[model samples]
Target: MTAPLHWKLVIDTTDAQTLADFWAAALGYEVEDQSRLIAQLLSSGDLPEAAVTEHDGRRAFRGLAAVRHPEDPYDAFTGIGAGRRLLFQDVPEPKTVKNRLHIDVHAEPDGRDDLVARLETLGATRLREVNQGPAGHWWVMLDPEGNEFCVA
Candidate 1:
């Protein structure tokens, strides 16, 4: 039998921490706390001061942040998720093309509208509403940095 590979979705953004926070709140996930790891690396002179930033009053990597499913296991020392996770990394260039991949958020049918509204309040923008006559109905939304995702 073949073994399944573990993976996390990585997204490029202009502001990693901001996007990570938005995704964490939108998906009911938790932002990975790497303060301890950052401190350890800094103390060891392995990570430079320029590579660090502060988020929510805690040390974080300057151009990186991540969110993970609350129930997932993770490395205690490094604060890296071992299961479902999303990593956001900063890139110099702006997104110029439509995404080849996107995330679809499934909500209770009765609560989808509320969920969309809540996402909007979290800095997501409603791009459009998509209805497929019976297959499904969903809202196409853009995250704070304009990455596309769906609320279904």
Candidate 2:
């Protein structure tokens, strides 16, 4: 057990910042702030202006954005999370098929309906409700960019 390796789930999207914002709100996480790092790279000519964009009034890499658990440890200089995190990166192609892996959001007991509604308000589209006798109940949903996830 070579000390568990650190990892993050990377998602591809046409708009990384927008997806990151949606996920941050949905998961009660915080968006990583890399404005200071971006500024330093830009000033050093290591980063091109076209590769940056404004997100929440702060400079961000145009092709990348991420969200992490609010209490997770992160590198202050780069704003990169060292714990549970999700990185959204821009991709040229659109999602063409179902996801082989998806996130499952488990709500508090008896709070599934409310959670589903809240997620919808945040841009998730409910595809269908599923109820398997004794197996449990859940809602299959799609994120803003059509990524599949479930709420239970």
Candidate 1 structure quality by residue, lDDT tens digits, 1-152: 98999999999999999999999999999999999999999999999999999999999999999999999999999999999999999999999998999999999868999999999999999999999978989999999998899999
Which pairs of residues clash in candidate 1, taking residues 3 or more apart in a chain or in different chains? none
What is the lDDT for 31 in model 2? 95
List residue ranges in candidate 1 displaced over 4 A. Answer: none
What digit string (tens of lDDT, one per residue) describes model 2 on residues 1-152? 58999999999999999999999999999999999999999999999999999988899999899999989899999999999999999999999999999999999999999999999999999999999979989999999999999999
RMSD of 2: 0.7
- What TM-score does candidate 2 get on C-alpha atoms? 0.98
In model 1, the worst 10-residue window by lDDT is 104-113
